[model samples]
Target: MYNPVRRNRNIGTENQGFGQNNRLQISTPYGTLKSFYERIEKYQKEVRIINDHEFLFIEEETRENCHHTCTFDDLESIIKQIPKEDYGDLKFIILRQPKRKEEILSPV
Candidate 1:
């Protein structure tokens, strides 16, 4: 009756009750990014999946919470592309971006 697999599954289920939310939360040091959030912009957040290794979330409207990346490698280039004013506030929780089949195939 003492099955290791069963026990692990039960333990995992119980651990789920810990109220863990795996979403990323980023903050900036200089507040240059904060100014972008003052007025509402149309593109608040955009999530992009780079290849299969990493993902990123870009908050266009708000500078204070402008961007987040699941992994650094996936977003290094994208991060550089962001205006210096908005890069300071970036933070992230580990996650992968979902992509549409067509979007992935579309010519960039």
Candidate 2:
């Protein structure tokens, strides 16, 4: 499970809104996490810009959270480190909410 408190970092998205702490958590294997990165680094042979600062990446995690509208360039380096294997319990998504682009981009 993704325990930010255990990892000692408030990284990633918050499944809950302000004043709420309903973030979903999942248990991930240490070997899976390590190999995931190893494969990424080896397969990362290209780079593409998403926004001004971010780039595209094959981000994987235990929870299926919202995918940021824009990608960052910095993630390219990080993606390369992941291994090309199933991340066990981790829910892997190449992009964030990939199927909801139109809905996400539409004006309310």
Candidate 3:
């Protein structure tokens, strides 16, 4: 489960917003790009853009699933919400998803 208050406490003051220091820091695990999108749709009910290159996604508690997809329109909508700014280059900090036991056992 995603606990906003607890997550904030763990991240400390460093993670108050998406791009406070000219960087986009995503605090969730990074699964396959496809899974990432699916989780976003299922867990995140709302997506808010903080700046031209920074966005915040609030997610719901969900069981980990590998099957999921995010649409192009959905991504576009998110990009459009960000307020325009002259923030130089953009940086992303995404957590990598852990491999499942089944994946490790499956043959290539």
Evaluated against the true structure, the overall lDDT of model 1 is 0.43
Could you tell me every candidate's TM-score relative to the true structure?
Answer: 0.21, 0.18, 0.22
Q: Candidate 1 lDDT, tens digit per residue, 5-76?
A: 664343556675454675433333474665322433444344544333333444333235334434445555
Best by TM-score: 3
The C-alpha stretches of model 3 lying farther than 4 A from their native spots are: 1-65, 86-88, 91-97, 101-108
User: What lDDT tens digits, residue by residue, belong to model 2 across residues 1-108?
Assistant: 686568624346563344466444333466574532233321222335322233334643222554455444545545445553523333333542222333454423
Give stretches of model 2 more than 4 Å off. 1-71, 86-108
Model 3 is weakest, by summed lDDT over 10 consecutive residues, at 93-102
- TM-score of model number 2: 0.18
User: Higher TM-score: candidate 1 or 3?
Assistant: 3
lDDT score for residue 106 of model 1: 39
- Give one clash count per candidate, in the order shown: 6, 24, 1
Name the runs in model 1 displaced over 4 angstroms. Answer: 1-71, 96-108
